[model samples]
Target: MSLFASFEKLLSSILLPIAEKIDKQVHLSAVKKGMVVLTPILLLGSMAYPLKALKNVFSDSAAVQEWFINNTYLIDLLIKFSLGFIAIYTVIAIAYFLSEGYKIYTVGAIALSLFSYLILTTSVNPDGSLDIRFFDSKGLFTAIFVAIASVEIYRFFTERKLVIRMPEGVPDFVSSSFELITPTAFIAVLFISIRYFVADFTGGLLVPEILMEVLAPVVGSLDNLWVVWFVIMLRLLFWFFGIHSAVLSPILSPIFVQYLSENIAAKTLAEELPHFVTGGTFSAFVNFTGSGVTLGLVIAMMIAKTQRYRKVGQVSLVPSLFGINEPVLFGAPIILNPILFIPFVLGGSLIGIFPLVLMKYGFLAKPFFDPPYLPLFFEGYLTAFDWKTPFVQLVQIMASFCVYYPFFRIMDKQEMIREAEVQAEKEKKSVFSKKDDELLDELGLDF
Candidate 1:
């Protein structure tokens, strides 16, 4: 029992610091900006005649397909469906620039994308006016194919460090098979096959379905304790995707709205006492929580013990409350600290729970206010119910900070150890350099 207790403490200590650093360093803002701008291009490119058949591609839903068999619209839709791949490629190329930097594979990317676009466009109508019945597997294939291309493009530039490692004895071909190139090729081949068979090329087959499915279970089980796990998973995912609140907001808002809302789908929301006044089924609850822009990173700053990190924690506190953690993440350099693991996670957990607690207590009527990243102090109070939500929000923020405080101190100590190591290395180097300097004095090499 004692051993376990000690182990638990040690683990928490290590994790607390690690978590804190991660909270600070995560970056998704740039990705969100790129995605937002890319949406229109993706929509337009997915059509046979981007300008004319664009509307047709969108309208070719199951209802349209059932109603308009053998129609001209279908043909156009297929053309556009494949063409959507070009749009995805273009968007990805642009978004890559927005999110990260440059890629070495531009020559191949440009060549393949242009060819795919030409095939997709010319298939339905050379003049760019096609129909909606074109919604076939090719469309799906094109979209995925393009998306894969763009994602790979975006990831290459945006990747901080290569996290993937080649296994010790794995064959090169087998190892490289799972890499982005092979799977993307497979998707393209599969999509082309589907397009040829179905005639309607714009397919919505796999990736979207996968994305939806992944979100479904987590969104569906709003009341489960596992929801916390869902939230944590989301945070981790955002980290992987480049930590942008904008990207996370759209994904998370619906779930949070569902959590605080009684009315779902066609059903009315369950009635509850008005907390702040807006009361019942607000999306704000989710938004504010994800705005993890606040002192969540400050907690990491606190856990950081080095003089540099301490200055970071102390300095970033004010801005952090306004929901901006980037300053601290970059400034403190806490992207991968192990000790701050505790507070970093708990902070988000508490932020999510803060409104939940209020919603439950009838202190707030409903979580109606959408979470925002700026103006940190007023962040929580923006929720629909009780004024205490703000106070509670404040408390939650403090709790995040507090959780990281001791652990940060421990990490600060660790930073000192690191600095010491650096200094020691420098000193050893200096000794060798000193001898060289002395020899230079005799040799007259000194300037």
Candidate 2:
């Protein structure tokens, strides 16, 4: 009859089951875990530029400037090897994980996937070396698709016992080397055929470019506020169901990074902000404190009457402040909690909308610099290279708090009631056990 009860029924009947299904789906599970495995390195890569950005703050100081100038090589090194090769890592990770799920040999699968990915992305420089552009974010979608497809092919051949098998006397290392030959050759040929022989759908565009074109309408529409909201909303929705949002990152990150790149280019040319929505916009602004903007929710919980809320809030608060929310999401158990469904998602979606409105009215500037590792509001300010953006972030935090507050209170009350019931049941059990103990003592005397 109550709102919480209705929520419980709905979640049990629909949301929880669907979430379980998603978590169990092989490909989706692979994508989620694979991307998660890559998050740390990607996060480190994202942080690489912040050192340079911090150095810029002291540009007027000769000693500080000299130190940064001397260390520019290090900054470049971090960004280049890490973020620069992100697509390569993504493909290898996806292939490795998918192969793991299919019970295929991981190392060979990764090698095959990497080889096939390179085949599809083969581009030559004027100096005859391989062009590295597609090895980065530009080739992300290609990398993901190729990784998945290549692994499937590997699984197909290996599962059917199509590969040459070594006799019992051979070493595993030597045996695997021979076993890898057939599947690797097949994977190589498959991609090679698609690369060279497949008919061009969009006037000689390669697979990645063609895929980009197919996704163009959606990517192009990101400039619209509604589309941005929808994308962010969908991400939050998945997170609520315990799905790792990074599964969609390869698809969305390229678009976000492209828009951010355009913003950087425009700034270099002294032009206007090319687009309002960007990767930096989401990373530095919308997801200021991780998915669901749960820093605000963490704060709300910190003030709650429920003991569980307060404890989890304390544990999650500091991390959420820095844009990580897993401690609370899993600890407070946000997933499948009906009381949190509205706030966890809708609150996060709200964070994305505020920036668009601010940009429309000239209250905030579009982000230009791509600084990372900086904390929430600071990250926003650095990205925009404008002080006002931090102020906007503060306002957004307050707005998020307002959005999460009501639902949080309801959840807090539910927790308190549950705790009370649990305590009463424990006391009742203890009383009955004590009475039984007394009766047992009297019977022991007769015995």
Candidate 3:
């Protein structure tokens, strides 16, 4: 009957059960966050063979192997999806360890996530056995690290009643979890390390078979850009219609990259060699949502700056159109308002079209598709040698900024207008009240 009770029921029905299961474990270590990212990064390992798999599954390509290499760039996008697993797991793990402590269920959840990847890795590879080899080294390190985390997580769970007996040398906020480290703090450390590893690998293209990734965008015509373009457009459309961006990303990005490799293969080795390592998307702006369209959250940040000149002209430009409007939406308070939705859709549309046009022309070379993931910016340069990819990126950014700037300015001015009206109304009300009081005395009025 009460609002709180309704809310409790809703939460328990939806989020609470999931929270309860993971709550069985408590982890407060940097390693725990690594677990958060571990799933996504590991899952990306599967993207290494998208087109090839599609080629085989559909028997689509005349040369499946060639198509496979051509679309190699999608691997990165596939790998990036694994990061989502890590993020979800890490948050749940951290939340549980902080609130409920650690238990067998906690370990099971963590193990479930890891094994999910392991099973995925094994089943995906036909010839390769359980990769018990990497399991020894990487797996061992991960296990020991997991043990430390589980120990802390377990203690935190059963010992929740003793949080007041918090560690003597520790800070207060951290003591809330009954765990050794906060999820955020530990995850940050894990982030730095994983980021380092992704960038640090010396191998030219050495994601193990267990972690091999593929980009299998289903295309209609094998030799045509129109088909590829159609696929790309379909991918963009899916952002509005559905959640297949993750499934489609590995396919669309590799189209142009495949072209780039062929177009420039005879020209120079620098242009033909795959530039990105691990074959995933590097554009922070784009994700499973597609590049530049990160979300309304990005748009929110841009609008939040509090200055029209700062907020409108330059702030929302680069991010809004590229599909990353989280800055503009959250920053600007355009959220939940009908007025701002006009610019959001319009800006996104205009910015989205320009690059595809340029790619159609000779102005920009298509990306080489090694480690395939959709790229929004110059990061598309990660593909095999398309020297002009940077130019195309610059244009996309400039175009996105241009379209978003005017729209943002309009919105900012409107925002200012509303604020002025509110202030004016307040001032007028105050003056009228004081005048009425004086006039009332003149009339000798007393209610």
Q: Which one is best on TM-score?
A: 2
lDDT of 3 by residue, 137-210 (tens): 22222332334443444444435643234768787544544433343244345534543464467333222321
lDDT of 1 by residue, 266-335 (tens): 1122354232211122223333323333365565655554667768878777655554556665565544
Q: Whose lDDT is higher: candidate 2's or candidate 3's?
A: 2
| Model with the higher TM-score, candidate 1 or 3 | 1
User: Can you give the TM-score per candidate against the true fold?
Assistant: 0.42, 0.72, 0.36
Candidate 3 CA-lDDT value: 0.41
Question: How good is model 2 by TM-score?
Answer: 0.72
Worst 10 residues of 2 by lDDT: 260-269
Q: After superposition, how far is residue 204 of candidate 1 from its true place, in Å?
A: 30
Angstrom error of the Cα, residue 323, model 2: value is: 5.0
Worst 10 residues of 1 by lDDT: 260-269
- Model 2, which residues run further than 4 Å from truth? 1-14, 40-55, 61-78, 125-127, 199-203, 220-223, 231-348, 356-362, 365-386, 400-447
Whole-model lDDT values for every prediction: 0.45, 0.76, 0.41
Residue-level lDDT tens digits of model 2 in 66-94:
88878888877776676667778878888
Q: Output the better candidate (1/3) by lDDT.
A: 1
| Models ranked on lDDT | 2, 1, 3
